[model samples]
Structure formats: C-alpha cells, structure tokens
Target chain A: MLSMVKECRRTKVFKPVLDHIPYAKFIGMGCEQFGDEYIFTLPSNDNNLGNPTLPAIHGGVLGGFLENSAIIHLLLKLDTPRLPKTIDFSIDYLRAGRHKDTFAICEITRQGRRAANVSMYAWQTKQSEPTAVARAHFLLEST
Target chain B: MKENNEALADFCQRGMADIKHSEVLGIETVSASNESITLKLPYSLNLVGDMETGALHGGAIFTLADQTSGFAVFSHLHPQIRIAPTLDLRIDHMRKSTKGMDLFCTARCYRYTDNIAFTRAVLYENDIDNPVAHAVGSFMFLETVKDQGWLK
Candidate 1:
C-alpha cells in the first residue's frame, strides 16, 4: 500500500487530472497546481487520428482524468487515506480534439464524508474551444 | 470472403494497433453485415495490484465503451472516414464485475446522420444475465480539415 502511494506520487497519476487513469505517460495528461486552479494537460500522440485529428484522446481518457481530478481534490482537502470509487460520470465532448494538445481545469463543488462532486472543462489548443465538459461523483473508502 | 467482413477485420486491426497504449477490452463479432459490435471488458488493463482482484476498473470499462462505440461507428463509414474523440458519453455502473472475470459489451449504432452518430453499449461480466454497466455515447465526424490555429 505504501509502495502504491509512493508510485502514485512518483507518477503523474497522483497529480490532478492525471491520476487513476491508464496511459498517462504516453498521452501527456500531467497535473500542475497553478495557484487557484488545478490544470491538466493532454499531449498529442501518434494514435490520435481522424478527420480533424486529435491526440486521439479517448473519451474514456477524459472520463478518467475528470474522475481523478475529483478524488484527488477530495484527498488533498481531507486528512484521510482512502481510495475513491466512481459512482457515475457524465462527459460531454463538445468538439473533437485537434492534434496540437489539450487539457482541463477542474474544481470541486462538494465534498462529503462518503461522496464528492466535481466539474471541469477540457480545452484544446487548435480548436481553442471547450472540447469536453464533465461532472463526476465519487465514493470515498474508509480510512 | 465479403467486403463487409474485410472491413470489420480492418477496423479491429486499426483499433487494436497500439496494444500497450490501449488494450483490447472485448471484441464481439456481430453479424457479418457489420450491423452491431459488442466488446467485452478488457481484463488486463488496470492499475497495478488492482488487476489481481479481477475487479474491473471503472475507467477501463468507460474506455472500452468509448473505443467500442467508436469502432461501431467506423464499421459503417467509407474506407477513408474516421472518427475522433467521443462527443459525449454517459456511463453507469450497475454492479461490480466478477473477480478475475472477463466482461462482455454489446454496442450498436441506432442512428447515423451527416454530423454525428449515436451508439449504446451494454457491459456484462461473468453472467450475461446481469450487466455490470451501461453506456450511451455519440461521436462526431472529423470529415473536414481546418487550420488548427494553435499551431501558429
């Protein structure tokens, strides 16, 4: 367990918008705490292709990023060591991701003993538009 | 032996090109006509140590649904046509998957218009009788190329 936590800290997974998801290293979904905002960036890779072309950031990747953002926010605020279970996630892909790059800035709306709620917007460079938006619910484990 | 079958094989190949980056969650061969595609949960892809419990991670499941849905749409498109990111997706976990279990997913596109295509995915684990989760999603065609202003 301690090693997992250590792994979490060593990797981008412990960072906001990047944790708890697969392929973080390849996709470039890194986390940075920028003063009041928690920013997550999704870097483009070889697989992201289509008409408009994208890092091909899959919706599942976006969902994972948002979900991680929510739980990490809760973890940062609390004095507990509990893992979070995703209750539900709803994501709206507003625009297709362009090859340049993209990411999201998230904020926690509510944090309770058992559950937490978070919302975020994903913006890409080429489109300069909000490509996706998400709201997720998480259940915290007991410490 | 048929054009449709050839296409299905190609689609799966392209989808699974990057095994390390994206594991095959599940692949269900629907009818030969490319009517519907169902994929199972990708048992192998998950957090370390977490994989041992055989519990299907929600993120993996969601990614599977998205990829399956994307493939479902791609199967019907022209050879050159391809889809980008999912425009929208909503997933609900009905229950946890069985331990060390493989999941099943059935994805179908009910409607296909010029701009967007819609799909539904049903995911099951040990028992097909009860599904572990359900997902409904849509993807938009990136048919046009624009000067992505960000590059400048």
Candidate 2:
C-alpha cells in the first residue's frame, strides 16, 4: 500500500523533469517513470533515419537516445534542480537500428557525491538482444 | 573509374541524399577528398541544450562528427562498399561551443582491413588547434573488397 503511494508521487515529480529537456522533445522521445524505473521510447521519424539504403536510424540518434535516457534517470533519481553535465560518453552499437520505434531502459550502475555513472540498453524488437549499450558519466552539481 | 572532379561532385550530392541525419542537421559540404571529408554544421535553435545559457546540445555535434566519419569512409571506398555499421564510438568534449557559431568537422579514415575500419574526427568552430570536441571510432564494413582501381 505504501509502495503504491510512493510510486504515484514519484511519477508526478519526475514527469515534469523529463519535459524540460529540449533535445528529448525535439527528437520526439517520450518517457514513463515509476519510482526509479524509466522506459524511454524513440518514435520512428524521417529525420532520425541515417541510411536511406536500409532506412536505419542514425548512429548519432541511437547514441543520443541512450545518452538522454541516462541523464533523465539520473535526474529523477537524484531529484536535482537540473540535469548533470556529461563528462564523457562511450557507446557500442551491437546491431543496426532499423526503421521502427526504439526503446531503451537505463540502469544506474554506481553513484557518488560529485559524480554518477549509468548504463543504458536499447532494443527495438527483442529486449534480450539490445541494439546498443552505453555508459556515461556525469558531473553533478550541489543537490 | 570516375575522375577526381566527378567523384568529388558525386560524393557531395549522394552523401546528402544517402544520409537523412546529415540533411536534418543542415550539414554543408566544405571539401572532399579520397582520404578525408570536411563539413560544416550551422547553429540552430533546435540544437540548444540549455535555454538559460543557449548552449548547443552535445548530441548535435556528435551526430555531425559521426556522419563525417562515415562519409569519409564512404568517399575513399565508394564502389567497393555499401554499408559500414559502427562498432564503437567515443567523444570527448573539450569546452562549450560559442553560441550561434557554425561547427566544422573533419574526419579521416586512418586504417581499414577486411572487416573493420578505424576513423578519427575533430570538431572545431574557428581553428583546428582549438577544438570543441575529438572523437575516435571504429566501424565494421559489410563487405570488403580490394580495388586495384583504387590503388591507381
């Protein structure tokens, strides 16, 4: 009972935080948050396609989506005034992101006072097989 | 085999056509060569990361650099290759770019074997020495072929 209430309160708090990111809105990414869990969706759009041959999503778009997911999760989890600045980003593309709606889930691997690290897994069809995985570190401001 | 002039023109048109991501970013071809490709990214309000400070989003620069690297690989080995999936990519941001200034990127294909190609790119606004970001990445070529025509 208490857990359900806690979930409702978290959604109310974090939903607005996600909307403030302009790139997320520009890219047409939508989010659903419950507690610390987040599901990020990237809608299939003409602008996101990189290869006109296979109609694959741009590698940058893939990288951006995962990166944004990490930032949002960290923001919501910490409940800070703004999102942390990115330190560095590394991405490994496991497969081609075909023209379709893509989804990503972020897991916080570690957290400290001044910095936080997060890992992201993105998949289009099969959750078991991720299209790309990324690790990003961010510098947090005073919380 | 296409002459140098014809190949350069072809690369510019086909590169803009083949990659929708570049078109969306308003990438303009500055120069092209068999070895490297250079392009420009104009500043856009849509790319701003912070409304308060008016800073351009890092992702926009990242997309530009990634596309430049892919195009560099394509310009060098055009007839023999079609697709190169990125195996890994890394970008290090040095400093925030000046708002409303165009970002210039140059990508060079350092080496490639049968299955993999390595690329490095630099993003700058006014000068190459003072860069906004640096990226080193690798891609997997779908098909590998040794073109004797390319050698000559």
Candidate 3:
C-alpha cells in the first residue's frame, strides 16, 4: 500500500480522473496530496449555497464532494484504471457547512473483488468536528 | 382551485429563487401542492459525470432529489416554516441517467414532527416507473416547540 501511494504520488496519477469529472470542475473541487493520503477541497462559491439565510453550503454539493473524494481516493489506491460506479450513498449532516472552504478525507473500510465500501468525513473549520460524514458503495470493474 | 394553483406557483418561484444551487442546476417547478411537489432539472453539459458515456452525474441527480424533498417539506408546512435544513440524506442510484434528457423529481413529506420532517423522492427522465435514483431525507424544522405549538 505504501509503495502504491508513493508511486501514485510520484506519477500524479489522479489528475486525469479528477479532471474528467465535469461536475467536480463546475464546483471548483480540487485535491492535494497529504503524506500518504489525499485531502479534497471544495472552495467557497456563491453558487454552492443551499440556504442563503444561514449562508450554508448546499447539502448536495457536500455530498458530491464526498462522493468524488471517495472515488479519487479509490483511484489512487486501487490498480484499476476504470472509474468506480456508485451504487448507493448515505450522508449525515452533522452541522451546517458554512459558506467557506470545506475539506474531506475518505477511508476505504472494506474492499472485495467486485465491490468496495468507502467512508468519508468533511469539515469546514476544524477537522475534529466534521460538518458531514458519508459512506458509499461502489462497483469496481474487474481487471 | 385556481387561486390555490396560483399560490403554489408563487410559492415555488419564491422557494427556487432563494436557493442558489437550484438555480445553478436550472431547476424549475413542474407542479406543487401541500401534499407533494414535482421539480424538473434540464440536462446540461456541465453536469456530466462520465465523459465517455455522457451520463448525468450522480451528484446532480442527488441535488435534484434533495432540493425536491426540501420543497416537499416546505409545501407541506406552507406558512408554518420558512426553511428546513437537511439533517441527513440517502440516495440509491438505480442506473446511470440517460444523456441529453431532462430529469424530474417528485417528492412527498411522508411524516413530520415538531422538530424533524421526513421526505422521500424519486428521480426519473420521462417515466416515473423507470427511475434513475431514489432518495430519502430528513430535515430539521429549526423552529422552537413553542412556535410550532407541539405541546398544544
């Protein structure tokens, strides 16, 4: 796993996958390598707001970021070049995501031959207090 | 009946205007009532998730469902509440959405308490029978028990 992470870091293999997702581009989502992990960032944008009264980020935008983060994380970890197809996604909105920079990290809880489960957490100001947490299952193509 | 329809139309317009993300997605209200609300999302090139297949992003579909569900809750509550923030949402993608086709979502507030509202919605292209995704969401009412008159 460490070697794969190092190789991906050296090659910057996740760029094309992230670049190809239009929604990610539309929302201005970006990813950065952090040691052995990657941290996904959703920059503050007025178009991403759900409730302007509270000035909170849209729940769906946060969901999208988390889902995309998981997919990118999978791409970095797994050897398959094909994009994973999401089967189902569940999210818990713990707090209102302020209209600001939000970050997310994904952890692969389990990986099987054909399916993988990833859990994601997103935070705005503090990493310890996540604004939202989500889990998703994806169908991976067999190599 | 005509008066109610006009009122619903006005409500839908005002609701969509307040949400920036809905506007970004080009969402429009098809029909709305206190019982249920239906919304439409026009297909856009920017919403494509996979360029090879030209499929609509799951995030876009999820956004449609989430906004529709919130509208369902709002329509159900009508004058009682101004906004209900999402507490949690779950979406199950049945299949990839067809390219160059608009999406529709119909949502209903199945249950509500003093503090929380529960809603379910389905997203489809043309036929509701063939849905692309199904979603269930819980929203916080953000109103006090006294204001909601739950004790009474």
Candidate 4:
C-alpha cells in the first residue's frame, strides 16, 4: 500500500494536478492506486477537528477530496485535455469520521462526453465500515 | 450607510482570501446589510467554463455559501474584528441550475449573537421563487484568530 501511494506521487498523471492545489501542500493529500480504483488519504490536520474533545473531519474537506479525486481519475483515464467541473454532488455521512488516519476510495461509474459520474466511500484506519459516501457528477470542459 | 456596506464588502473579500478557493471564483459583493448579501458569479468562473449547459459545480456553491454566510455576520461586526470560521454547513439540492446563466446568491444571517452566528443562503440563476439550492451554516467567532492555531 505504501509503495502504491509512493508510485502515485511520482506519476505524471497525478503530480501536476496535485501541484496546482497549494492547500494540498499544507494538508498532505495523497493517493494510492489499485487496479481500477484509487484511495485518497489526508493526514489529520488541525482544521479537521471540531470541538477538540472529539476529532471529526470537516465535511467540506471530505467533499473537496472526493470531488478532486473524481476529476483526477477522469483526467487520467480519458486523457482529458482540460479541467472538469463538478456539476452536482451529494454526500451522506453514514457515520462520523475518525480523526486518526482518514482515507476515501473512489469508483468511477460512468464517463460521458460532457459529464462523468463517480462515487466514493470514506473510512478511518482499522475500521470495517464506511464513515461517509458521496456521489458526484463532473462536467468536462470541451476541448 | 452605503459606504459602510462597501467597507463590509471589502472586509469580506479580504477574509475570504484566506480560504484560497475564492481566488479563482473572484467573489465580489454587489450589496449587503445586517440581513443578507448578494454575490455574483460569471460565466468563465464556471468549473467547466460553460455555465449555459447547467454545469454549475457543488464546490462553487459550497464556497459561495461559506462566503455569503461569513459576510452575513462580518458585515455586522466592528471593522477591526476578525471573521469567524465555518463550524458546519448543511445544503440540500433542490434542482439543477439553468446552463449558461449567471448565478446570484442571497445569503441571510438568521442569528448573530456573541460567539456564534447562524446563516441560510439561497442560490438562483434567474428565478427567485424557485432556487437551485438551499444551505444553512454556522460560524464561530473568535476574539483573536492567531490564537486559534486549530484553524491552520
């Protein structure tokens, strides 16, 4: 798993997109690619916490990760010449995300000419269940 | 009074720059009061650069709600006071926005007391009665933002 994560960091497909987002620099957003899916992980940061007594990952950060992963996957698969926009997204928090080592896995459902549909399930380390699931549609920019 | 509104708008633009998301969208307030603020989004700002196709992205909407709500409270604060961070936000999608149309946001400050403020926002393309989405959020005001290292 660590090797796969390292491979993603070196790959041309992932590096440029990661470079574009400076916040990712502070947050440490990285991914590990398997056969057809990718697992995105964010090392616990301070902004992710709620009341400090309980560590809950912020929903906005989670949503942004899912949205970015979906588009990045599309860019890698179809050789997208331009950036894709997320037209709609719906996230259901099945459970609270643990602040300890969080990660999300993405599954691309469909990639149309102008739109791509994708889903992601997020879980904490050593957990058997998913904490949150999101379905998002990305509108590809016409080349 | 209008000058105060303009100053508040300037303050919001400054606070929002901290997020970095607004740097790309270029959020500028047309008008604001203690109640609500109106935001304008252009066509090129579309994530897909084709708003006419109803391709408005959710991240854009989230950022807008975050800002409008932030301004909804910061507008009422003293000039030197720092803006608050969003504690949480809940958005329910109503319908897809019309493609190729500009987005106008009307965010309302429902409750602004001492430490926390509550806000609700409605996003529209051309229709007022029928909105594209509705969102509610809470912001936590702090006396000194630098002391709150947790936000970083």
What are the chain A TM-scores for all the models, listed individually? 0.71, 0.87, 0.90, 0.80
Clashing pairs in 2: none
Taking every candidate in turn, the Cα RMSD to the unseen true structure, in Å, is 6.0, 5.3, 4.4, 8.4
Question: What's the best-to-worst order under TM-score?
Answer: 3, 2, 1, 4
Task: Compare the candidates by DockQ and give the number of the best one.
Answer: 3
lDDT of 3 at B86: 90
Q: Evaluate all candidate structures by whole-model CA lDDT and list the values in order.
A: 0.61, 0.78, 0.85, 0.62
Question: On residues B51-109, what C-alpha lDDT tens digit does candidate 1 reach at each position?
Answer: 33446556667777776777778656535445444788888877766666676776777
Task: Report the C-alpha lDDT of model 3 over A55-134, residue by residue, as the tens digit.
Answer: 78989898988988998788788875577889999999999999999999999999999999999999989999999999
Please write out the lDDT profile of model 1 over residues A21-100, one tens digit for every residue.
34343344566655545566666654433322234455666666565555555555444455566778889977655565
Ranking by lDDT: 3, 2, 4, 1
Instruction: Please report the TM-score between candidate 1 and the true structure.
Output: 0.72
User: Least accurate stretch of 10 residues (summed lDDT) in model 4 chain B?
Assistant: B43-52
Distance from true position, residue B140, model 2, in Å?
Answer: 0.6
- Writing each residue's lDDT as its tens digit, candidate 3 over B61-145 gives 8889888998788776666554578999999999999989999999989998878889999999999999999999999876633
Provide the DockQ value for model 4: 0.11
What's the true lDDT of residue B38 in model 2?
84
lDDT of 4 at A1: 23
Candidate 2: regions farther than 4 A off: A1-15, B1-6, B78-82, B144-152
Between which residue pairs do clashes occur in model 3?
A: none
Q: Which residue runs does candidate 1 get wrong by more than 4 Å?
A: A1-28, A43-55, A126-128, B1-10, B18-33, B45-54, B75-85, B142-152
CAPRI grade of model 1: acceptable
Model 4: per-residue lDDT, tens digit, A78-122? 655565665666665565555767787777798787888888777
